[model samples]
Target: MSPTIEAISAMPNGEKPTYLLVMLHGWGANYQDFVPFAKMLNFPGFGYFFPNAPFEHFQVPGGRAWYALEENEFTGLATSRKLLLNWLTSLEASTGVPLDRTVMAGFSQGGAMTLDVGLTLPLAAICSFSGYLHYQPEFQDNKTFPPTMIIHGQQDPVVPIEAAKKAQDELTKIGVSVQYQEFMMGHEVQDPAIALFKQFIQDNLNFN
Candidate 1:
């Protein structure tokens, strides 16, 4: 696995983890941020990995960013994308979980990244919460994508709901099977969304 990004992981208690879940924190958040969040899911027998973004946040002390938000074209995005892709592709070797049984999900900027690299990989599924699509997609007409879940807050102030909708539209146009949801909240995860997320993972994972 690439040593470029630092990460933290956990295995289910009393059982051998049979699947892998990679959670990417949003901009300004560190790997530690998702530790408790993962617990909230109450998922069992699945290993969890939370990878720290490579770059430091320019404004928030002790916070990290996938890329800087200064340029009209997000600077650092390409670099982060490459590093994340490398790390994810190499992950199965270290975790004993193949990409076909792995799910890559994220929030905010990290969610943007979920779509960024997740679209290109043969992951079991990819999910984005309160996230947006960064680039104008240029996929082939017949390309197939993993099962995707896009969730956003109807009253979100940070990332407008429209961005999520636009992402849904674009992805659908490309023949991606997407399950989109709009919750009754803001720029944060809530109970209902968590339930949906859990179900989504269970439904897509190749577990008998």
Candidate 2:
């Protein structure tokens, strides 16, 4: 069976969609986490897809997680990446949008996954919020860079600001065109971050 996916799509009254944005949610959250923000975006000809993580988070009832978070285990990260990739492939098959016209954006853990999948896939852009790139060193020899925007909170306790900075530095070292922004908040996404996200999409997607 195909993976479960929840999506919201918008197109100008007469025009076909030219771009697609995939929003991946943070840990312990479901597809609904991005619905409100997706609605706030002003991409008239862009279609949006928000897919729920494959696993259920232990701590939060009725909440989903990309993978299980266990001590000394990075399996969750790998699992999430594969599942997301599968979902993206299925979405492309159904929507008829080429991978080059697709963008992936995520928050927190989802942000990390966005970086992982975006780098490995042939995507146009990636936007990450409250997240960091953890596997930059591995991609050094691969030398594939996607236009990426990273937004983090200066006071984020879950993922430290220092870690985010380090991730930016590593990506820059490898010639990745990365745009980094920080907000005066915590682990949550703030208005400034959202504004930057909007601008990043508009600039990269060429939405008039």
Candidate 3:
């Protein structure tokens, strides 16, 4: 059986949802980190899921991490990737929303995972907020990558802005439609990014 990561879900008060948005939080942050986005980026008929990372942070108390960053190496990326992939692939059965109607997004470390496993799945769209790529995915003729938005802060220090630029070039090489953006900020998502996020999600997902 595939492991199911714990998650927090939010939905508009209505009937069954037509689309799903899965938000992945950054390192040292729990699933609750992005829960507010569900309300702040309210979309009718769209349900949101924020899944907790599989491991507890080794240092930061009350924090969670998808994988450990230790000794300048990614210690548990493979495990986190597998768990996230399994959880995401199982979403349709649990939510009654298929992968084609779902969008995956993340921030910082979470953003890296978004590009990692997300590209492998048949999602409707993907948004990487202040996110970077871990490594370039090998080209696969059978895999169809969804349209993607890679947005970053020009002044970002946590994950440098170059990460986003590098990601753009790498993804483009693989034939992925990329919507790239840069903001005059640092290490976080602001109003401008949120605005683009709203527009991007609207353009990509099907709503009832």
All candidates' TM-scores?
A: 0.94, 0.88, 0.94
lDDT by residue (37-103, candidate 3, tens digit) is: 9889888888999999888888989788887765367777888888888889888897899999999
Tens-digit lDDT string for candidate 1 (10-74): 87684666788899999898998888766787676688899999988988999999988755778
Which residue runs does candidate 1 get wrong by more than 4 Å?
A: 1-3, 206-208
lDDT of 1 at 119: 93
lDDT of every predicted structure (CA atoms): 0.89, 0.78, 0.87
Q: After superposition, how far is residue 92 of candidate 3 from its true place, in Å?
A: 1.1
**TM-score, cand. 3 vs. native:** 0.94
Q: How much RMSD separates candidate 2 from the native structure?
A: 2.6
Q: Write out the backbone clash pairs for model 2.
A: none
lDDT-best of 1 and 2? 1
Q: What does the lDDT read for residue 67 in candidate 3?
A: 78
Sort by TM-score, top down from the best: 1, 3, 2
